[model samples]
Target: MAANTDETTDAELVAEIARQVPDASADEAAAIAVAIGAHLTDRQRAAAAAAAAAGSEETWDGKEWSFSGRIDATQKRHVRVRQESPTDPWSAAGRTDRM
Candidate 1:
């Protein structure tokens, strides 16, 4: 099951990321957690708008968005996001990569 992003704090996100990726340093985990938190927040808003405007029979094309940021002095993380776009069933809000 996915963690509920609504109630998750930055510290909690960092902890969860650490648990999921034991090899990442503390700073790396924290960076990735923050990025994930932002992604989830944006997706939640899009889902709400889609719910309001979407038809029951609507079908979305598969899409994935990568959220990238500097994790540390030596490395970075790229998060691949996939979900239904708001109001538009053919593309994501910012960027689109076919999944």
Candidate 2:
């Protein structure tokens, strides 16, 4: 006869992973998520890496800046771009390809 059994779900797996990396920050958690996602498919890994690299921003002269901010429930804007203009003339050409 077949016996009833319990199985671990993807959420359970992720939670187990998170439990293992207790010291991980929010960013680290996201990286771990991508890595786990990558193991499932090669295309997903490449896409995750590309997305990670593309989101990295640096100053005009190649200097990187660290920033942090948040919006409360009163103002729930998904994205905010703070550039000099719609067409940022100061940005180096060819950098657009990175995205």
Candidate 3:
């Protein structure tokens, strides 16, 4: 029997196994494929949940920091916030001759 972690598709693996064991019934092969797929799906879901719970924060150039927010399907494309100072380089460019 092939190792479970070989990364072969369930259908490919089932066909290979059936070729090797001609006595195995189609129902048995199908059952094995369904079981393996379910196990892999459950493991993937658990891993994703754990990763989301361990949220990470990052800073750029040791000066600016950014945070990630979860957006649902109904949320707007952009969220607006007021800043004390303008952050647009184009707007600030006309005010100063530097650069």
Report, for every candidate in turn, its global Cα lDDT versus the true structure.
0.56, 0.46, 0.49
lDDT of 1 by residue, 1-99 (tens): 235545545787788899999999998897787677778778998998888886564443332222222212223444434444443532333342332
TM-score of each: 0.40, 0.27, 0.40
Q: Residue 53 deviation, candidate 1, in Å?
A: 2.7
Clashes of 3: 0
Which candidate do you rate higher for TM-score, 2 or 3? 3
Expressed as tens digits, the lDDT of each residue in 36-73 for candidate 2 is: 55565566768999998887744333222111122222
Clashes of 2: 0
Candidate 2: minimum summed lDDT over ten consecutive residues — where? 63-72
Q: Which segments of model 1 are wrong by more than 4 Å?
A: 1-9, 54-99
**Each model's RMSD to truth, in Å?**
22.5, 19.9, 14.1
The lowest-lDDT stretch of 10 consecutive residues in candidate 3 is: 63-72
Model 1: pairs clashing at backbone N, Cα or C within 3 Å: none
